[model samples]
Target: MFWVLLLLLAWAVAGAACTRLCLAAARAAAVGDTGAGIGSGRDLTLYEAAFLSGGPRRVADVTLVAMARQRRLLLAHTGWATVVDPRGRDEMERSVIGAIGPEGQSPIAPVRAAAATADAVRGIADRLVRAGLAVPDGAGTTIADAVRQVRLAVPVVAGLGAVALLMPAPAEMPRHLIAMWFALPLTLTLSCLAMARFEVHPYSRWASPAGQRLLGALPRHTDGAADDRTYLTCVAVRGIRAVGEPDLRAAFAHRERYLGQDDGR
Candidate 1:
């Protein structure tokens, strides 16, 4: 039937898209695993951990949180960062301080953005990629794009099937047969999507499989001020909101909000 031809075309397109996406993801995962040396004695640094657990922004966040806790910088809940000490204790600290500029005070948002793009952060990312602890930028982008394509195609497939069933049928062509025919492709697409999610979702973001394993092995401290640095380290690797200090959490939240507005500009 004429309607059947249209439904077949839709099915072909959806099937091809799903197949391509799944194959690409599988290839990327395979390459990543080969590049990532299993049981290698290499240890993850704090900066690398931050990058793996989050990304460039997380590295900047860790640096800022460290300086704030050390009294080298002041992170106000008002969404501003102020310099308490002009001297930076390390390269990362120096980068953050430099991003804050000579005014000694600026909105935390811009500072975060600057720090994320700083040379120091790039160096860390470069080293991580070289060591195969982080995903290659291109590979990560490909995986993300593929995932998005599959997601968009799902609705298209469903719509096509619905339209095929609603179309006027000839006396000889049964609606039940049409429904069954459309269901085959729809089921195939859904199955492929589920498989891709199960296989790729874990390694879809910043860290490679090896890096994720290391992150899982990181310790979580429940003690008080004595482990404040450790706690902050956890926050950096996980997220700012994990920090229990209300004021500190507010500082990070304000920075995020300010950054969102600044980005819109």
Candidate 2:
């Protein structure tokens, strides 16, 4: 019957989505990261730590905070960033300066955005990927996309089942029987989602398991009296919110508000 056709479609949709998600998760889980690359023996640099903890954006954040602290850049509480030194100490600093443009001043929000996508940041990501500490660019996205597809399929399957139930049924085949058939696909999708939550959901978009281990091994920096290394390490790992200075925190908050306003436009 036509309802049987709809039931078949439902099964196809649910099966394809769940299979794709499970395969993607399995593939991701298979590609293991071992400590055999450039970063094996050495402690993670601030940039590396930043990338592993929060990706390219965190690298830009830490660089901006470091330069601002050293008086090489001015991060005002009103969201503007002024370059005090034209010469950058490194490529990351140079990227931030370049992002600010020739006028030597720009909003911190745009500066952070441009710096995060700059070649310096890309290079950091490349190195981390090569070192087996970071997820490959689109590798993590595969799992995420598959999960989304499966989630979408759940409602689609339910809708198909509802439509089938509304249509004519055979003389002997009961309406509840058709519902039970639909319920099979629903159960499949739901069970897969639950399993994914435990098995594959810990998959980080930036750091691999090896990278996570390294991050966990780093000493925690929580005190206000920490040295520059400790303080910057904290900022790199935990982002701008970890900044102990009230002014620095205020500057970033202003940047966030400015971003919201800019996005509305």
Candidate 3:
């Protein structure tokens, strides 16, 4: 029957996607296993924490915020960044300055884009991966992308099933039977998504389970903290929205709207 062929196609799509996701998850778990005792009692640097919490772009955000706070860089509410101090205190700050260009002034958006992909950020990512605290590039389903694929598959299977039901079905086989056949793939996708939710919800795009544990152990700071270190730490782990200063937060908020960046969740 034509419906039978469609059902087979549905199963193929669901099986391939779900299998890939499961394999990725398994590989990620294996990485976690091998990372045992790594980074134990070792504190995360602001850059490391930024990468683990939100990847390279976040690292750029942290560096910009830190420099701006220290008055080494000027972040205008109009999304422009001006270099105040020619000398960078660290590699990260230097990267941002370089991204701002030889003129020492640039739009915050382009600078952020450039700085995020800079070698400094890559180095941080590499170190985190080596330490088993972050996922490697193209880690397949081990990253949040895999879960997203599975999520997409669910709706695809449902739509395909609906299409198949509208097609001609053998009288003896029955439309109900055809629908049941389609349900298998849908069920498979749903089951996988459910498992991922329960087992590894809010799947980190950057950190592995071992890394996540360390991140969880980091001290949480409230908005009232006066120390720049504590304040920057919160921004590093939590993002720009965590900035307590209205001027500082407004600066980032303006940048986000201009560049379509997230609120640093």
Candidate 4:
């Protein structure tokens, strides 16, 4: 009977954890910004598209990659970025050039950090959010939190199973019955996880549903002058590593290393 009480307690804890995850996921989904409409007919500029698909940092990355590809900026494997043209063709390019400062050159790490936080990037994000093409910060946080909660289900179930197995058994007590009882909580946790993956995993981290649809509708280009735009789009969608140039890839990798260090602290 004592062992039964212990098992019930374990089950109760698992049930409570599963309940919390389910409720969190429900709240996240319920409050998710469905956006203005499926087709608001709003066109996305390169920077706006980047923000919708990958957020502000991606907008900065696309701007840097585009400038580097155009020979306006030089990205070295040593993590230095030097201005070659000193002239920016657009607002985003101008922001990146400005972030490099009066020296006309700077480490890619600091340049990327500054570019991401630039006023132009903030403006792009704001526009995208207002147009319903980008996820609002609060909603994104909610979905992220729910995903994290669901991820805990596995460990919670494992801990409960361990507790059940460690309980002392007396004569006439069915060990198999205890194992079967443990299955109940495990089932609950697994069900909640499956439901979340099915329901919430379709949405991208940065873009809302309308934003995703717009991203899908963006035109592809293969012409010579359009190649830079194509590459920038690819970087905005698939990330910096999609850039084929070894030196350029290294430049972004160096930036990531510093960002990782900052996150660790």
Candidate 5:
């Protein structure tokens, strides 16, 4: 039982660690932006990581509504005016869709407008944190299941490091203890890199797909409860530099920044 638990823990820690490194790297590569349009039928190419991690990966299809295509269709129909979007109405607010387009579907409209798409794209990133897919910052279990899994893995990771030190290690660098010491750190570092790499490509693909499918799947409204948890966790993790420290400041500050950038702010 002890050994069994240990192995499971090791696997969990490895999984959690991998999850963090990937998300962090993806966020960094994206310059703090988690682009939109994931799981939308319009763009399916960004499914790389979705495919790689399969269903177990938190950021993929699970949080998205299966009938999400209909939602976009509604946005398009109700606001066909502003919906005359080159990339569809992705950037425009759904409420104002008509005024923005009504009929400007002039074939000459530019195919993509990144700035216009900013609101929708950022909204998705903020929401993912809400759904418990991303880390919650500091120590709280933002994604309870994932966090618990990661916590379990921590000891396992430590155990592996300890065990590896006492065992015969590869001779490529050196033999015995010294090799194990160097090898452990290097392995950990590479694992971190591998995890981060996982966060980038697929999400970005969602933001830039042809049908704008990735951009389309985002819920028009942000998730408030999830947003609160995300804000508290991020501030706790970010410490003094946290955007908003308390309720009032957090409410206004976060709202002004990203969709739910507020919370504990």
Candidate 6:
């Protein structure tokens, strides 16, 4: 029984990790193939879909709402940010990132939260186009389509997670060894997601609030669209708006400085 308990714990952790890896793989696979001559935008769309996956239906929606809100935030800033923590609403108010707020609320309290990401997308696209760092119609629409698919895929991922948790552990080494069944496709998917996430711009959900703030994933900010100034380049792989050259070398330099100084990191 003790060994079984240990096995169960091991299974749970391993399963969860594998599941995350698998999900990521699926996303990467759908994102695009670098060697296939796919456009940057098409590649990104594949990535966007990979990111929309998550938990129970409601959880998935909340995650999406967060993503949408973040994208919107990039559009405009309303100041303070609000969140529904495990505590209550009272635990929400203070904007100091640690201040106090309304308390004693039920689980999953519905509240309005502003998005800082949407505005970011809009802002970067507009600026990058002006700076000539990008090429136009460069998969913008494709990226949007990918975002939609990713949002749709979220629930499916959540369901899969729950099921994986309940799945019985393999009984023998042979089962594990012969289990190349789901691995190949999964590996391929992951490779694709990696390609999409890095090679493509605008499609990287990791650039969004939903992906970053909630999912704890970090943006690369080191790929094709990685212009620091003009906010044209996102720390993600998604899209490329048309560019015309505005000479932003100094601005890019400053932006890089700010990123380095952020949180004193």
Top candidate (lDDT): 3
Top TM-score prediction, candidate number: 3
lDDT string, candidate 1, 84-192, tens digits: 9989877888999999999999888889889989999889888877766777776634455666677777777778878877889889889888878777777877777
Candidates in descending TM-score order:
3, 1, 4, 2, 6, 5
Query: 63-115, model 4: which lDDT tens digit per residue?
Result: 88888888889999988899999888877888899999999999888887788
Candidate 6 segments exceeding 4 Å error: 34-265
Candidate 2 residues lying further than 4 Å off, grouped into runs, are 33-42, 138-140, 162-171, 218-228, 243-247, 253-265
Off by over 4 Å in 3: 219-221, 253-265
Clashes of 4: 0
Q: Each prediction's TM-score against the native?
A: 0.85, 0.78, 0.90, 0.80, 0.23, 0.24
lDDT of each: 0.75, 0.82, 0.82, 0.71, 0.33, 0.30
Model 3 lDDT tens row, 17-100: 888888878877877777756756678999999898888888999899889988989998767899999898888888899999
Question: TM-score of the candidate numbered 5?
Answer: 0.23
Q: What's the ranking of the predictions by lDDT, best on top?
A: 3, 2, 1, 4, 5, 6
**lDDT of each residue in 141-239, candidate 5, tens digit only:** 222233344445555566665554556544553434443444453465455544434533343221222122333343223234546334333322222
Give the per-residue lDDT of model 2 (tens digit) for 154-249.
999999999999988998899999899899999999898888888766545577656766787775567866789988888887777788888887
Error of 1 at 71 (Å): 1.5
TM-score of 2: 0.78
In Å, residue 120's CA in model 4 sits off its true spot by: 1.3
Task: Give candidate 1 regions above 4 Å deviation.
Answer: 5-9, 140-145, 220-226, 256-258, 261-265
Please count the clashing residue pairs in each candidate, in the order shown: 0, 0, 0, 0, 18, 42
Worst 10 residues of 4 by lDDT: 30-39
Better candidate number, 2 or 4, judged by TM-score: 4
